[model samples]
Structure formats: structure tokens, C-alpha cells
Target: MNSRLQHLLEQWSNDQFTEADKQELIEMLRSASAEREIIPVLQDMWEKTEDEGLFSEEHQQTIIKNILDRYPAGELPDKKEIVPTMYAIHRTHFIRRWRWAVASSVALIIGIGAYYWYQHMQGKRPVDMVQSTTRVQPGQNGALLTLSNGSQVLLDTLQNGRIVLQGGVVARIRNGILLYEGTGSEVQYNTISTPKGRQFQLQLSDGTNVWLNAESSIRYPVTFAGNERLVRIIGEVFLEVAQNPSIPFRVDVNGSTWLEVLGTSFNVNAYENEGAIRTTLQEGSLRVVGDRFNGHLQKVLSPGQQALTTKGNADIRVFDDVNAASVTAWKDGVFDFNNVPLEEAMRQLARWYDIEVVYQQPVPKVQLGGTIKRSLPFADVLYFLGKVGLHYKLEGNRRLIVLP
Candidate 1:
């Protein structure tokens, strides 16, 4: 508002100030009563960046052009994305009017022109064309190792390359994953844990690839030593077990369900909170020990079929067009919920988003049917739910409120 300040800003536009003047102005921003009150004047100075001075001037126009180049108008806007917001704000503040303002008084801020441009160009908006977001969370080295001496180390730490040798085995952490190589005859036990809002994949000593879902842990031997290879899993895991018929591989969970497999690909969904233990075979046969009474309770399974065990004898059933992709989408980075109830869908969301579940209304009447990106900021999931016709709101960045 002061003529003196306006004069100084005008001089700045003419490239009269030294670098010290720029530093002084920047420092004033932190101390001034109305620090941003001077911004309009400073913005005028940026016009100098466009037309270079004989000595020096503003290169702002060139710089903005470069930054905007990194982001082009793409398909769908990720609901929880910041890029669009940044672009929107940037367009709002610049590129508004080419109306030549001969007087320096009206050119207080450089963005006034662009702000008007945004106001007029509102209706002809670009629509969603690309994927809103990638429906998968990045993989994390979420392994927790319980040592032979009853000690536990979170393997995800030691982020850099480090070798931890124990029980005649060499376990290394490259980046975040725990890599192992065995040398000795002794079998040592270790456990890998994935907390809420996280997941992990590991290769057991017997060459079984285990994909553990959120809020889960799997305990297994460091090396397969003798006749049998055994492991205990809590929560859920997709197993691609190695084949060795001579020595039976067993997975023990709960009290009744015991899985015996010989070289096969299968999945076990046995979360502690869930009432049933489901063992779905993808390739080989697994005998389910439903009742501790007899070994005969073991049921065989073929591809495209599933076995459900509930304290008693396990039942095997076939499915129509088994949801292979949706069922195993977590391994590939997705939550493919096709016609699943909100209560059931929230279970997966609760684990991945690391949030507590509390419904605000009669469980939503709608069924969730879509694939959502796991890595997106949790709100993206809720936003997509709304976009898909569900009525819900976010609370405290950690809760979802469903409105009836």
C-alpha cells in the first residue's frame, strides 16, 4: 500500500535490486506483521523473469513452464491425489489475463490474471479417462524373525544391506526383504509378522513362497533339517509349497485344522477373528485334519475348488468361475471385492488402512464390487466408495462413517 514499497517493487521489475535485496525481502516475510501483504509487490517482480534484463531479470516464466511439463492432463484424477490440487492452484494463480496493464498499481500480484482465467474456464472441464489410482499398495519387507534363542528381530529394519547369520544359516536384509541361505543341519525357528495396514511375501527354507496379509504372522524353520517340514501361520497366507513326498509338510493352525501338503500351490485363510479356516487349493492336494480324532478327516481338493473347515469335518465345494484374480489380488496389489458385503469388505479395508471399524448405520445395504488401490492414501478408498454410490464419510483420517 505504501508508495515507497510500490516504487521499490517497480524497480525490482526493472532488475535494479541486487541478490541481497532479494534475501532481505525473503527474510522480511518471516517477521513482518502482514508478511504476505508484500506478496503482491513481489509477484510483480517476477514479470522481470520473463523478459531478461541486460544485467539480470526473472526466469520465472521459464521455470513454471518446466514444472508444469512434468504433469500433463491425464485420465482419471486420483481422488486423494495432490497433483491435481497443485495443478489447479497453480493455474488459478497464473495464466489469467493477457490484458496489458500499463500502470504498475494494478499489477500487484502476477496471478490476478490467471485467477480470472480459471473463473471463466470452469465449465469445459476434462473428465476422467485414466485409472483413478493404482489399486495396490507397495510391497513392504514386513518380516519378523524369532531366533532360535527365543529372541525376535524385526527384519524390516536393518534397511540397508546387512548379513545376520544364526543357527548355521545366513539371513540377509537387502533393502527391506529378509533373504536367507542355509548351510547347517540344525533347524531353527523364525517368525515373520505383518502388522495392520501392511503385507509381506517370503520364501521358506523348503522353497515355499508365502504371501502374508495384514495383521498376520507365520512361524517356520530357518532350515528344513529332518524328515518333516512344519510351520504355523496365524492370520492368512498364500502358500506355494515345495514338493517332497518322503517328508510330509504340515501347517498347524487353531486346534483342529492341520494342513498336510506335498508340492502344491494353495491358500489358507484362517484369521483368528474369523470363525472358519478356508484352505483353497490351486494346484496340489492337501488333507485337512478337521477333527483331531482321526487322520481320515483329511479331504482332497482339485484346482478351481475350495475346502472349508469348521471344528468338525472339512467340506469341499466347487465354485462358479472362482475369483482367482480377486481372491489373490492382494499378492498382486489390489482389493478386488466383487459383490461382497460392506461388513466383509470393511474387514479387508480395516487391515489395509490400519483403522478401527465402527459402523454408523445399519450395515450399508450396498455390496462392494470393485478393485481399489491399496497404496492410495486411505481416503481415496472412501472417495471411490462414494463415487460408486455408497454413502460414507471420513473421520479423523482413521475412521469411515457409513450413512444409511
Candidate 2:
């Protein structure tokens, strides 16, 4: 037996293994030669817990099978050739110190049974098995559409058909997308707002597409009439403007910032709770102008660039080589937390899950990485967080209290 492996086994048996120890154990498990020694240690540990009824015989076998399935006989690839697969069972980055969570969720295979066993011994229930009836579903496609006449329509429940608006303008709903048809000289404004736990998609009369994230609202004219197409947005929005050099597109974010679109696709995050309004350009060019008390501060953003401006501040900061894909991941139904801080990640969960996050203590200085599907159940998402040492409690049905 290797001395280092022996030390790791001892740490595991004593419930004193640090994150580095667990990572080293995972690496050893990847190799075939080490498996010969590691498997017996796990079996021995399981046998010791058998009398205590920690896990059923069937459950123990399933855990062993899951671990073995990762490295089949004579099929384990070389260590240097292992490439991380996206959204794999083993590929999930959990809490701040759990760096291996960034590799995959399957990395928990070695610790899961032990985790349950320890919880049993400690007379505590697992997070998933907690006696709570509260269930918070994930966000879905939905929005509140306010017409020019102050009449509101719920887009999620409305059937697919043509919606007649003022000035003879027609807005059609097809497969959860709001599409506009026909032109009207009478300019009437319409607003689409998505509440918490909902998102929406829209297409302007000029063929420009718009995606509204949760807790967002966009107000635009029913038809494009002026030399420049303009819209006002609050919260986050992604726009794919139709190319029309003759009539440029413009966006007014929170009545404080403006985005001059030069026929391109970009995303604007102007949530009031956020520290700064971020404008990330996916492709083409955009000029971000800030309304300062003295004058206007502006910056031109190229592809993969992000411009951040604070409310009531004149200076605009540009971040070059930004991850535009990660910035726009929400538009594609993903929560990309690539180097995002803990509170910010919680804010996203608050919006998507329609839950308020109450911290029981001072916020932990933790940075999170990796991506999670927006469609996962709230509890499942919490389970991943628990694996990384995040202790949380669901209060009632909509409040998530983070414990220190």
C-alpha cells in the first residue's frame, strides 16, 4: 500500500480528510493499479457500517457500480488524455473551496455514501431528506404584455394567434414567442415585463429579436417610425437588432444609460440590485453612453468586450476580452457563474426561483465557478450547493435562508 494512499484512507476513516485529500483520492481512483487497493478499503468501510444499517445492500452495490462504471475494465483512458465533458454527471463545480466540483458531479461518488453514513451516525438528516414540504420550481418562459391601451395580457397562458393592438398593429404569439406584423404610422408604446421566475422572447416589427430575462421589462413603440429605433429597458435584456444603417437602433437602460447599436447583437444587464450596469457585445459594434451630471461618458465596445457603468457615475469602464458567451448564458437558459461571487450567484437564484435569500450571518467570501441548468428543481440546485459546504434552509415556500 502506498504511504500517501494509506494516509488518505486514514483521514477518510477518521472523517478528517481535507479537500486536497479528497482530490488526491479521486486522482488515485482514476488509475487502474490504485483501484485494486482502494476498492477493498471502501468495501471494508461499508462492511463496518453494515451492522448499523447505514445503507441497504442494494444501495451499497449501486454505489460501487457507479464508481466502477467510470473506469471500466481495460477501458480507462490515459491520465493525460482525459478531457472534461460539459454537463457530465461528474462535471459540477460546487462551493468555493470544493475545486473538484468544477470537474464533475460524479466526483462525489466516493464521498456520497460516506456522507450519508456520517449523517446517520451524527443523528442528522441529509438535506434532500429534510422534512420540508416546500417546493420551488425553476423559472420558465412567461411574461406580462401591456398593450398601448393599458390592457395587459399574460403571454404564457394565451393561445397562439394574432393579437390585435391599437393602430391596427398585429402582434402574434407562436410557440411562446411574440412576433409583430404590419406597420402603423400611429406610434403607440407597448411594454413587456417578466416577473420573477419568468422570461420572455419578442420580435419587433423591424425583425429585431429581443429576449427578456427575469424581473425585466422593455417598453418599445408598436412600430418603428422615426429615423432611429429606440426602446427603454429595465433589468436585463439581450437584443439582436436587424441591420438597418439608415435607421440605427438605440436602447435606454433604466433612464440613466444608453446603448447606441450599430446593427449588432448584445446584452445589457441593468438590474437595480446589481452594482453596475453591464453591456456585453456578442458581435458587431455598440457605443455605450452614460448620462453623467457633468456630461456624457461613452465607450465603443467591440465583439467580446464589456462596458460597465454605475448609476449616477460619469465614468464608463471597458473590460476587454470578456466572456460574452458567459454573459449571455442566461439568454440560453443557463446560469454561468464563471468566477462569480457567492451573493451574485444567490441573486440569480432569487430571481429565477422566486425566492428571497436571507443570510443568517455575514456573507461568506466565496467565489463560485461552472454552469448550472436553469431548469433544475430548486432542491436539486440546493443539493449541489450543500455538497460544497453551503448550509441552507428553505423557509416556508419562497425564502432561502443561508446559514453560517
Candidate 3:
């Protein structure tokens, strides 16, 4: 056994190596002679991710041959081939990592960081490693529409057309978007809710376009009335307020904080589970106010700014140079994490996939930074998280046991 290879492989598995050490490992793989020995050792280490009988000798040989085919025999390949081979190695180990089960508290696969190359096939035979029976799918365009009289409609299955007629306002679903037209003679409240694994869009009677995030709800009047236009929200939403200077648009969150706007395009994340309510402005302006017994504290947010507040908190902090794209990426079907904590990132995974998170040990203080498509399976997201040294296992059916 090569002590250098073993030591480096161990360090590499734990992501404890430097760039120089990684380069050394790459050089070792370049040699067909060295690869012959390294492949078996790596395979032996990776087999820990799978249970008995799941990984076979034939599969190991096939994977080895597949990796070897990328490099020329008895000759060091060029940079292009070398880089791809490294990725292929990483991909293969990642694929293997997902088949893990925690039979004991101590992780059996201590030699993680192995990549498994997998081709995700949707609607086909579900992957067993993903626990297909209980695997949660990503959030989709869906919501529950509650009419003024309390009649409920599942917007996802509801066909496009005039869906509701209440208080003289005509509610229609056009191309998957719920829209309300005409003025209501009387004030009536309608609420649209996006469940844990769903989202939807709406156009209010005033022409404001609103995008709701998963696990969010927005309550507004069927038509504008009185001195001002008001709406209530919980969770996250992106709004493009229609210009109506005569009647300012106000967003009330949990009755403790609110945003007043004449006309603006902004995103508000008021998820009850999150630490703070974040209001990010993409265009125009708005006043974020936190209601307090000693009068309300307010902050004016310009384009490209974000205000952070909490329910009943008098102080509202503003972050100027925020990643607005990251703030609203969920609306665009992506998970963008920029220096986000492991707990926060997992919370996002939990909501979008409708899974519960369980920590066997104290949660690690690790920050992840990247963008991943929210459409991937829960296991696929776990694989991406694994790349950043965060290990997790899917428990029973709906719980994810995160490992340190």
C-alpha cells in the first residue's frame, strides 16, 4: 500500500488538504500505473456509503474502467483530459455518497468526499438511493385561493378562465396567473396561500403583479376601496406595485411591520421561520416600518437596498450591497446561497422539499455559497451540500438527519 496515497486520500476525503496536495493527487492519477492501484483503494473507501449487496465487484470494475478510459494508457493526458477526469472522479464519488444510511451514531463513511457520477432521470424509474417512495419533489406553481365567501380553489388544477365573481370584481386565471379585474362595489377580502411546496402569482385589481414564494400567503381586498390600498402577508413575496399616487399601497406583515409604497418593484421575505423579515428593493422606493408601542420606526429603502426588521422590533437595519438576485432567486426556480449558514440553507431545503430537518449532533457552523436548481431531487441537493463537506441522511420518510 502507498502510504502517501493513503494519507492524501484520507485528507482529501475530509477536505483537509491544500491546493498543492490536490495538485499532487492529480499528478498521481495522470500515471496509469498509479491509477491502477489508486482506483481499488478509492473504491474500497467509497463502498462504505452503500450497504452490503448494493455495491458489487462488477460495478466497481466498470466504474474503474470508465474512469481509466478518460486517460491515455502509459501517457500523461493533456490538461483538458486531466481536469475532466478529476470531475468524473468527483462525480462518481458523489453518486455513491447518496446511498448512505446511519445505522449507528458514528458515521460509517468517515472517508466521505467521494463523488458519484449520476444522470438524473425524472419520471422514470426512481432512484432507490433517493428513497423514492418518500422522496419529496421540488416546489411548483400552485396555491390555494380563498374567495371572500371562504370558497377555496386549487389554482394549479383550476383551468384558465373566469374562476370567481365576487363583490362586482371578476377573478380570472389567465396563463396560470390569477387576475382580478373591475372594481368591487363593497370591500371583500380574498387570500391566496402557497403551501410548503408550492408558489403562485397574481395580478390584483389595481394591476400590481405579485409573486408568492413557497409557504407564503397574501390577503388583499378583491378591489381597491377607501383611502389606501392595503394587503397582508406572511412568508415571502415579490411585488411590482402599480402606480397609484392617490392611494398608496401598503403591505402589512404579521400586523407588526409594514411597507408603504406608491409604486415600486421589491421582494419581501417574511417567513416566520426565518430570523428577520427582509425587504429587498429592486426598483423604485418604499418605506419599511416596524410598529412599536413608542411610535413606529421607519426606514426609506431605495433601489438596490434591503431593510431587515423583526416583528415588534423598533430597529430596522439596512444592508446596501445585498445580493438582490440571491434574495429573489427562489421566485425564478433557483436556490442561491451566498455565505449562508448550514442551518439556514437546510431550512430552505426543508420548506421547498417539504421535509423535516433533524440534527443528530450539534449543527456545524459551516457557510455554503452557490446556486443550485431547485428542480433537483432532495438527494441531488444533498449531494451538492456534500460537496461542501456537509453530510446528511434521509431518515424514515420525511426527516433529514444532518451529520457533523
Candidate 4:
């Protein structure tokens, strides 16, 4: 494929292909159809993308060439979307402009690749790398905090920097989590909330720790007082309860589900898009509760065990797994691709690096697995994947198009 032609095709797939350029594509398709085959591999690519993968950039070129060699001889139709692109990603912050940006990024990146595949595979184009936007953006990253006295605070902004004492208290942000330390007779309560696509953590005065996941929140006091410690939440969280046999700890979520513990460690996952609320116990023992069902308690679990609660449906299921590494991979800074779907893997990529994903054809059902440096540039990551057999082409400098 001619390098310029290939770049243009990728840009087309990205929706970055302008109207005038599209007219050119129509002309090329019409002429090529009479002398060469233009069988698109988007359908094939979508079916098993998760199970199988492309080996390298060279292999991708080969696939492109093979497809181009298969187009039937005829004058092609002028400019109707012959190839299908999966624009199915939804529920993303529900904002119009962001969605458009996301859509544009995906369309241009993927469209260019699809169009290039059509022309080049037939010996009409060349393969020279082009640059476009591959850095897709994930949703919001903010937190809503509520104090014990029914007061609220937003933590997303850099307000005075140090959240030390309001009246002689000391607060710290360590390991990306907030913590408070101070000696005072009055114990003030506080809450922390995270918006969709965001996460935050905190450490309480009594040494009980908590981590708030995306679209979730937690309510606690500045200091642990009275006979026991109590807190409430509506989303996902992880807790490391301070060992206090005399004073039990409790967590209230979903207006019904509850957990009690003395000294233990566990995690919770209750994102809105996801249907279940899961608590994976890493150490110690805890009790589960629910409001939907009268007898809605789960079995006690040992280390490496978990409890799950479904939305609207009130039934807790206990599952056992000893691989703590898999559960805690995100926290430890590793992109764990353990048999993940093409869409899901791309979604994670979009979130961490702030980029968008667009499929020129349908998404393949191949399962991808591996770990890589999350900080690597999008091109380097794609290049590595191409070396591993995934076919793709870049346009401009931002879009990532999925090739068949």
C-alpha cells in the first residue's frame, strides 16, 4: 500500500476522512472493484478477536494484502458504508460533546485502517506509519466528601494543599490515599465520594483504612470514638479494619447490605454499570447482610475468598479463590489481561491513558492476556500488539482504529 494512501484510509475510518477525501475513496472503490477483489476482514476480525490475535505488524500487512486480493470484480457502489463499524460503547458520562469526541476518535482511527485495507491488500497502497490521536479519555475523576456534622467537602480541587486539622488535626495524602492524624476531644465525622471513572483512598484515626473505587463513596469520622466504629457507603470500597475485638466495625451499603468485622482486610466492587456488588475477603472474617431478602447473609470466608451481592436481587454468593494477586492487580500498578475481551481491554486502555477506541468493523471475540507498562505511548503499545499479530493503522495523531 502507498504510505499516503494507507494513512488516508486510516483517517477515513477515523471519521477524520473529510467529505472531499471520501469522494476520492468512492472513486477508488468503484475502479478497483472492476479489476480487483475488496473482501473486507472486519467481520472475521470481530468474531474471534478475543480468542486469537494478530502476531506482528508484518503479519498485519499480510492480512491486509490477503483481504484486498479477494474483492470480487465489478463496479462497486458509490459511497455507502460497505464496511460496518461497531459504535456500541455507551453510558459514558452521558455528555454530548465528550461522547462526540470519543466517537470521532474511534471512527477516524478505525476508518482509515479499514479503507487502507481495502485498497492496499489489492496492491494499490503502501504501508508507511501515520500518526493520529490514540489517547482516548475515560470519564470523570472527582470526589464528594461529607463530614460528621452533616457538612460536605469536594476533594478534587487543590484547596490549601494540606488537609491537616480544622482545629489542630493533621491530614496526609500518602500512597494516593488521604489520612488524618490529630488529638482532640471532639471527634468529627467525614465522608469521601468518587465520581464515575475515578478512585480515592483514605486512612482513619483509629488505623482502619478504606479505598473508594470509581463512582463510589465512604462516610467516616475524624476519630474513632464510643464503643464501636461505624461507616456507610453506596459504592465499591476496600477496607483494612483496625483490630479491635472490643469494638466491632461495620459498613452499610446499598441501604441494606452490611459487613461486620474486628480485624480483617477485604475489597468491594459495586459499580453502577456492573450488576453485582462483590466483597473479596483477603484476610480475617466478616459477616454479610442485605435488605431485599430476610435471610440475606453469606457464608464466612477464609483468606482469598469473596462474597457477591446482586443489584435489586438480594442474594449473597460465596466464592473461594486463593489468588490474591489477580484481585489486587490494579492497585499494584499492573495491566492484568487475564483472558479479557477486546472491548474490555480497550476500555481499560482508554481509561488509564485518556484515549478513545473505534472499530472499523465489528469487535473480534478474541481473549487477550498479558501485562505491559501502562505508561508506554499508545503507538508503542499498539506496535507491540501488532508484533503479536493485531492489525491496525494510525491516522493524524489521536485515533485508534480497529482493523479487520
The top-ranked prediction according to lDDT is 2
Instruction: Give per-residue lDDT, candidate 2, residue 144.
Output: 94
Q: Candidates sorted by lDDT, descending order?
A: 2, 3, 1, 4
- For model 1, how does the per-residue alpha-carbon lDDT over 1-404 read when each residue is reduced to its tens digit? 54556654445445464557544533443344533565444445334333323311123334333322221111232334423333332222322232121122222222233333433433343222112122233345466667777777765656756555575677766555566786656756778888886677777766788888888888888887778888898887898888889988988876668888888888787886677787777777777677646767666666656777765545533343455556777777667788766777878888876666777667768766756556554434554576667886545545556777
In the range 1-404, model 3's lDDT, one tens digit per residue, is 46676676555435365668656865664466865676555455454564444433354445343332221112223445443444333223334343321111011111111211121133343456546524577788889989888888888887587864666678898889998888777888999999888889999989999999889999999888889999999988999999999999999887778789999999998888897999999988899888734455888998889998887566899999877888888888778787777788888888888889989788876679856777666656765677678877666667778887
Specify the poorest-scoring 10-residue window by lDDT in model 3: 102-111
C-alpha lDDT of candidate 4 relative to the true structure: 0.58
Scored against the true structure, residue 281 in model 2 reaches a CA lDDT of: 96
lDDT by residue for model 4 over 1-80, one digit each (tens)? 23444455456434475657666655654564511322222222233233233333353334333332222112122223
Better of 1 and 4 by lDDT: 1
Better of 2 and 4 by lDDT: 2
**After superposition, candidate 1 runs with Cα above 4 Å error:** 1-140, 157-160, 163-165, 312-321
Poorly placed runs, candidate 4 (over 4 Å): 1-161, 164-168, 174-177, 183-187, 194-199, 213-216, 234-236, 292-296, 341-347, 354-363, 380-404
TM-score-sorted candidate list, best first = 2, 3, 1, 4
